[model samples]
Target: MPKTTAQLRQLWRAYECNEAEMAAIGFGPDRIRVARPAARAFTALAETMTRYRYFIRPADTDSYNCRTITGGTLKSLHAYGIALDVNWSTNPYVDHPGTRGPRFSPKPTQAERALDVKAGRADTDMTEAMIAEIESLCTATGLQLFKWGGHFGTLKDSMHFELDIGPDDLAGGLASR
Candidate 1:
């Protein structure tokens, strides 16, 4: 439930979070920073992933980057510390056909994903069941739901997830979806 790029630009003049507004999730070297309002949700997600044995390597996970969306000028949710990427090596960002330059390729379809699994090109840990369970935890005391990037139609950033509520909605304890 992120806002449109125009809305985001208007809401956040610089699309940057102050250090005081950020918190760390996970442990030690694997920890990632995120907006304080979303720390609880991300913590719950990390715990859920651990419980489900969906191991994520630190090298492949990222959060809270101050950057624009890839291939676009708009600021990315990461700039707001509300987005995260997990196991990026196994679940890559892919453009849909005709959406990007010819150098980019279409995202894998269900059939292609299955083939990737068979060929050891992708990991099987990010199952629908795991996603469902994580999403279900959104209503827990201090947590909020996350929208999986896999659901994007034009481009597939399967490794990404972001708070499903906006900053204002989060402050108001409301969920957009």
Candidate 2:
């Protein structure tokens, strides 16, 4: 069932967080939005992986929005800033078979993510080892990694990750209509 406005608001206390508070965490120029707890966790993550700071660094990924799942009805965690998308441009969301959903009509590519910009793009060269480290760091930071949409089996969203603190929706983040 869909949560009422009051319930959503109450549940958002520790999650939805104010924009000003989010700015203090040093998420870079994008001023990426993340829950208070999640932001602190990412701070630690960035410190741990100082060498590859650029990779884990938050990009211009979408944050809060309100909407149902792509084809379903439910509240998405993004409504509370619990979920964030990183490197979306380079990491495509693929909807493969076995996930019980149709494939993504137009798959994304690293080349496109590059936007034909200069060299040194994070998505340009990623090795299996790098992915593993990122996954391990994420787990250590109290976050869950959702690769290829995980069990969804429908979308191979390689560039996505969620804190798994609440419901995950695709229609839009908590703020999205």
Candidate 3:
């Protein structure tokens, strides 16, 4: 719902939740934190992943980092405790033909993908099936405001997910709950 980066940042500051406002979801070590407003959606996601036997390791799952984007000046949604990165070890972020150079091809060969993964340039575990399942789950869980970074045109951050709504909307939704 934020129209600009500044607006988004403002929203993040306004609605930024602490650890107590977060919910830990997933099984055993394969867990991640999400804002209370988004707990239900993420819980459902975790349950579905468990039901489908999706692979998500603790070291690869994280949330609520107070930092900017990897290489940009914009504040990350994780700084607001609303973004999550699942299985980042296997769902690496890749840059296409952009500022970071051409590391990702639209249709890459398995060998190329393997090399990319080894070189820390991309991931290999986020298969088409996984992507499809996650997208479908998000659509069905009333998490329409959550955006997947895999949809980025030039940058493929397949491990990332965040609620795209503004602070007021998020607060309102929480109030309704």
Candidate 4:
């Protein structure tokens, strides 16, 4: 069935909505942005945060930036509001350190952060216990609602959660759960 205008309005409201409201409630960033579609997933993602305190800081959460990946041609999922990076300062994209010479994967800033993490400078890094809970929360939907970057073998983006499918797929998954 075709969606009603009211439904469209609600969906658009979700898409263009600002994230300040969530931050006000002590969840995410104050002014961060995400597509309405992604925001729906965010709602489900937040369900498992009750036990995990100190998980996110305003400075560490990033989303909905219109830019390319650190050093790649593909546009970042953030640009499409399909990605969110949390605790990025401590948990970085520490793919093969001192490797991939001359390859522009993460750019210089990330390279430096990766080096720092390898040197054990990441005091705020999320432990496996944290990710384990987060994993349960994100996967609760059963549609593979979110992907934890920490699971990335070489990249190790420990502070990130992102979605690949559309909102309906995520919604269906979340509903089933």
Best by TM-score, which number? Answer: 1
Model 4, span 30-130: residue lDDT tens? 34566754565666555454344434567768777667667777556665565678767666666665433112223234445445565655422444454
Question: How far off is residue 74 in model 4, in Å?
Answer: 1.7
Answer with 1 or 3, whichever has the higher lDDT: 1
User: After superposition, which runs of candidate 3 have C-alpha atoms over 4 Å from their true positions?
Assistant: 1-10, 98-123, 138-145, 166-177
Worst 10 residues of 3 by lDDT: 99-108
- lDDT by residue for model 1 over 74-171, one digit each (tens)? 67878878789987866777666645211211233444544574464543336666677777655423444677776676766778987765455456
**What's model 2's lDDT at 87?**
60
Candidate order by lDDT, decreasing, is: 1, 3, 4, 2
Q: Quantify all predictions' global Cα lDDT against the true fold.
A: 0.66, 0.44, 0.61, 0.53
Which portions of model 2 miss their true places by more than 4 Å? 1-24, 45-50, 53-59, 99-126, 138-152, 165-177
Q: Kindly report which residue stretches of model 1 are placed more than 4 angstroms away from their true locations once superposed.
A: 1-17, 27-29, 98-125, 140-144, 171-177
lDDT, candidate 2, 25-134, per-residue tens: 54433445666556654454344334444444355456555544445565555656655555665555555546543222121443443543223232222233444555
Tens-place lDDT digits, model 3, residues 1-177: 324446656766754545666666664356667666666656655665655556567877888776787888766778777788876766678777754322332233444554666676554544455455655543332445556677666877877877665544644342112
Q: Candidate 4's error at 82, in angstroms?
A: 1.3
Clashes of 3: 0
Q: Which whole-number lDDT from 0 to 100 does residue 71 have in model 4?
A: 73
Give the TM-score (vs. native) of candidate 3: 0.67
